[model samples]
Target: MALLYNHLRDARIEWNRHQPQGGETEDEAEARAAAYNEKRRLKTVQSSRKSNKLNMRKKVAQKMVKLCFAKKDEEGVAAWTWFLKLLTELGNAGMSSEESEVGDMPTNSGALASVVVFAIRRCPWRLAMVNKYMEQIDEAALVVLTSGHSKHARVRTEQESEKFPPSGLPRAMYNPAWLTVQKTFLPDIEEILNFSEGSFTMMEVEVVIPGVN
Candidate 1:
């Protein structure tokens, strides 16, 4: 009899846990349940965001592989166009890394180090293009730095505009001021240019260290 009474008491307690409390009206019970569900929903969203952050490096690496290894020609208009596209993608990927960091955004130095390491792994041969793109970024960053505004139309005269190549795309399309993953990883950019196509294996080991970012 005691065991059956205890079982009944436990079942009653379990039922009451989900039911409205002694003084709670139907409206009050509904509001309380809604608040709890909202909290659970917010927690789910936060968990998903954290998961995305953890996967960022893997995602960026895969994208770099796709960009670097495709069968595009190595010279002329096709190559130039492909190279430009690759640069834009690299900058975008780096920007994504920055977005993960949120409140305390990393400096270009740290973020660039991480991205340069990633770039070298996926596409060492075209890594040299980083220098050219960096120059374009420097031009754009200069304009923004000096002017105190974000507008892009300040490139004065026709002669002065000659700094950007006629055949090339705009600095905005290429360097994109927000891409701190680095338009150019400064220290290694010149060194990367010196790597012979076959010599990258040894040089990569020396230059691409882990965890710099």
Candidate 2:
């Protein structure tokens, strides 16, 4: 919502700035734009409210709901609301290690991975979600933060070769795995990791370890 409102406000200011100060019918054009904006804004809110109801429903496999846009309407507002709503739910749910998410899959940069861990390895990732991980997680009481949000998240290994350009993505997993995505309120986020320009790769995450050290 904040993102959406900011964009709308910016667009309006730019529109007004272009008007002829004393030109004939200047006020009328401004009024028309304002009215049109209001209607669209209202619609955007309505869509968000509808999605909120859907978000509250608890489903293991169906965590996030995807929103669509009309051909001519701006999509930022709807996207903003959808993300904010996801964040609200995410903060409350303890993150799981067996899940993960990747943004715009076949895309580059600006991609984000939200790692939810109950324990911060003062060391490196153990390469697997162990039973020990589960135990620590339950006692750890975790919270996730992201520029974007989602429901189910998973862990993945990306081991890439230097010759290939992607050095972190694993060439292959010995164990049969359901590659997962580390989700955030918005998969679209700041370049938290310079992992890869496109394709998949391993990204680092900082977790607050559980218990009094």
Candidate 3:
């Protein structure tokens, strides 16, 4: 994950002032051309690295959920705790408190929602011990967190196409596992479900209309 951040931040340091200018000597123009090409190359690299970072987050979330399914309780808690720490560091480094008001970067709300969903479903008892830190989540993130509990709950992915497909999503309602999870978590799945009256209209659009992003 740190490696992914390193690749994302690489763009910030490699910026060079190399735009073509009028009345330049042949040698200077050649140097500028090379630098400009390097700039384009760096842009492509940064784009690929950004995709890698988002993909890594999905994989990490999936792995943590998988560990919970395997009933590796202790390992699940440890992995979840570590992942939360990583996200905190990433958010702070990318958008510090003082600068976030002026920044355009998206919040980690979706990622937090997905991670919390799996934690509530797979390891509520274990989560209770470590989730005190969740109180620090900002109001914007909290909104998205509760949004998933709504009936119109939509599963949004960071990538339209991923190399690794998701598996073992949380159980649907009325299933034994679903009931168990609902019983353990607060707010009653029933009350949360009552909050939303509409269904997710975009759920099947990906398959119905490919390349629509």
Candidate 4:
């Protein structure tokens, strides 16, 4: 959330700096000012939407974590299955957005990835339990990779391709390697487990552990 705030702040500052200054004709200055304001407005709307989506994901992830600690045996597995279904729903919501056409991939991808990793990390048994959801995971991963939002997509895909070499799934959808790379850059599952309320700010997390990004 802090990262989003900082990004929005930086964007506003950049736009303000680019605002028309002295020596420009009234018409030129007016047009430039209008453009700046419009762009800024659009960016604010985008940021707000992204923030809301992320908050929803965080809430869902927190619930899943709680279930992991609270439930046991068949009951635990059943609860996890339900929560995983919720994640699938969330991911589908993200994918259905028209914004993806404009370079705005689903903000929930990271959250979905995080929750899945958290489950696997905390409970090795979840690996087998989640095997049924592999298709959904692969789909979400494809969205992330093709959206061009992942910094390590190319390199990660290349590495995974050499190992598994892409059979039924796209090379980039290899869940283990994809999750590993996301975990490398994203906030730690332990930190997320500690979250009681409110959003987890990527900037704040990165600050606590310098050089992770």
Candidate 5:
């Protein structure tokens, strides 16, 4: 994943270097950058298809969640919550009611499932609040985490004959395996949850400004 990220970063830098910069106005520079970024996005999509790499945004989001959870602080919780909401909103966008059914398989469901699994694995203490937020979005986040593997299996079976499947498998499908691995070092979820609870506190304060009250 690091190799893939470095490759994409280098590609973007090369694109920027080749962009016309001779007496260009701010608007022109912005437009050129936007166009270059779109081209880079398409290149990334093609590269991912060819190499079976996960999308950079999703990979980074997952890593960010891991890092935030590792901190186990109030600020980390806030950041994780924000990212979870963003992922859920992104997954829910353009989804149909029927497609959102419990048994129905949606192409974008992986994003939400990934968020749920991360919460389960890293922030189980906040699972209740996570579920409440998911309800606001009309998603059964826990259900998705529990049942996503079967859905992914079905999709894989349906596309068994294809050279490349249309959608990548949900990261949630590997949660069980991850849990098994985690047990070697962190064997007690309850202990982790208790430790997290003791690690962070939220407080409110008033700020005074020099120019304004």
Candidate 6:
């Protein structure tokens, strides 16, 4: 849970931690250091090996360039175009320690709709974007994001699709957003996760629209 100190416009964070009391003399600490070094030498070598592999992964990501574009009202062509560019940047940073939080409407797309409404009422772009897009989306090319928890065994099932008939099983949350979706077809909630984004997580969503609209 998160709380906001409205007056300060800041969020208060709570977490559990263990505190350490310090009272070690320099000589006492030095004596332990020598023994620690002997044990740490091999561990350091192994850690470096892991770091090397991560570096290689980063290099591999640099070569991948998947560009997906969403068309908005002609006025928002640029914003839609920018969204695709942003995805490419995120792909490049795949090796970094950035974590995304995705939310699903498993409990109720209505609840998800409520959150969307709240966001739109407070900041309306594609005010009714989700419902609107889901009403018309293609499920075939849809990407899915599943829960990280093992309750579902880390698999994102296709439960039911709203987009098109063929879709990927659940994976993990990607990013969702309010798009200038036209009324054509509907995709399953799971299949359309990649189409939206609230900082790269499926659960956390953000819908965009033209500034003037």
Worst 10 residues of 1 by lDDT: 200-209
lDDT for each residue of candidate 1 in 1-213, tens digit (9 for 90 to 100):
999999999888655545677799877877776787687776565455334422432333333334334533233223334433444433322221111221232465765222211111111222334434333332433322333323222211212111211112233233333223333554443243232232111111111111221
lDDT of each: 0.35, 0.33, 0.35, 0.37, 0.37, 0.29
Model 2, residue 71: what's the lDDT? 29
* Every model's TM-score: 0.25, 0.21, 0.28, 0.28, 0.19, 0.19
State the displacement of the C-alpha of residue 31, model 5, in Å, after optimal TM-score superposition. 1.4
lDDT of 3 by residue, 65-180 (tens): 45454675665445544544434333311211110012133345733232211011122221222222222222113232333222222222222221111222212211344345
Give per-residue lDDT, candidate 5, residue 195: 27
Worst 10 residues of 5 by lDDT: 154-163
Q: If both were scored by lDDT, which would come out higher, candidate 1 or candidate 2? A: 1
RMSD of each: 20.7, 21.2, 20.3, 17.5, 19.8, 21.0
Judged by whole-model lDDT over C-alpha atoms, candidate 4 comes out at: 0.37
Runs in model 3 lying further than 4 Å from the true structure: 1-22, 72-213
Q: Once superposed on the true structure, which residue ranges of model 6 sit more than 4 Å away at CA? A: 1-35, 66-198, 202-213
Tens-place lDDT per residue, model 2, 1-213, is: 999999999998877754655564877667766777787876565445335423432221122112122222234334333334333332222122121224333214766554442221211222343223333332322231122334332233343211111123232211113222322432532233222343322222222231322
Candidate 6, residues 22-117: lDDT per residue as tens digits? 665666555555556665775565345335424433322222112112332342333333333433433321111211124343443445421111
Clashes of 4: 1
